[model samples]
Target: MDAIERDDDDIEFVETAYANVAEFVEQLLLPTYRRNPAKHRWDPRWWEYQEVAMRLEALWRSFEYLRLEGPTGMAVFFRDYLDPTMRELTSENGPFWRLDKLGDERGVPDAWPSESPPRNMF
Candidate 1:
């Protein structure tokens, strides 16, 4: 049926979006963990990062947990797909949210600090 096909496509789209978001979070957060093993694993910041990423992705597909303040459907994209606090920092050019900015605890860049990959056998 046409309805069944449409529903299936919608489900597929949601699954793909979630997968991409999860991959993005893993890539972004793993470096943080490596740079500050003691602090990140123990501190609430790590959980915050995970929570924000997960929630954002969920909202992107479902628009379930967001408050919007813009043109029709515009806020959904920003609210669901973006990190609210990080966006505040990066979108406004704030020092706390730059790729080159260092983390206060680890001295690693906010995104990726090192120019060379870690030397490993793997």
Candidate 2:
């Protein structure tokens, strides 16, 4: 049987990072949460929070670069792409969230599917 041994330290980093991200989301989304569910729209305000989450994730990914020096990488895409749009939105009394510069590259995707077959089904 092939088994995977998990490292508690890595898991701890992931857990802590996840908790931080959740807190960020909650703070940014509280306003929207107060509105009726069905009345939700693709308002600029919502996107501001989304961008903030992206930047936060990027900040977390930057930690990986610190421990592993194998490759050149940066997670500033979220800020790069969204900042201009957000700035424009906010300039005219539109909703927006000001996210710190995350850099030129965006953070990696939030989720990835397993490559292996299902357990006991293969």
TM-score of each: 0.27, 0.22
- Which residue pairs come into collision in candidate 2? 76-105, 77-105, 77-106, 78-106
* Best model per lDDT: 1
Give the per-residue lDDT of model 2 (tens digit) for 41-109.
Answer: 223233335554565455434433332333432224234433443344334222322222222222322
Query: For each candidate, what is the lDDT?
Result: 0.37, 0.36
Question: Which stretch of 10 consecutive residues in model 1 shows the poorest summed lDDT?
Answer: 35-44
lDDT of 1 by residue, 1-122 (tens): 01112343462212232245445345543343243322222222432444445553554334322222236444654554544544432332433232333344422234546676678935
What lDDT is obtained when candidate 2 is compared to the true structure? 0.36
Off by over 4 Å in 1: 1-20, 26-50, 59-76, 79-85, 88-101, 106-122
For model 2, what is the alpha-carbon lDDT of residue 102? 27
Q: How well does candidate 2 match the true structure, expressed as C-alpha RMSD?
A: 14.3
What would the TM-score be for candidate 2 when compared with the true structure? 0.22
Q: How does candidate 1 fare on TM-score?
A: 0.27
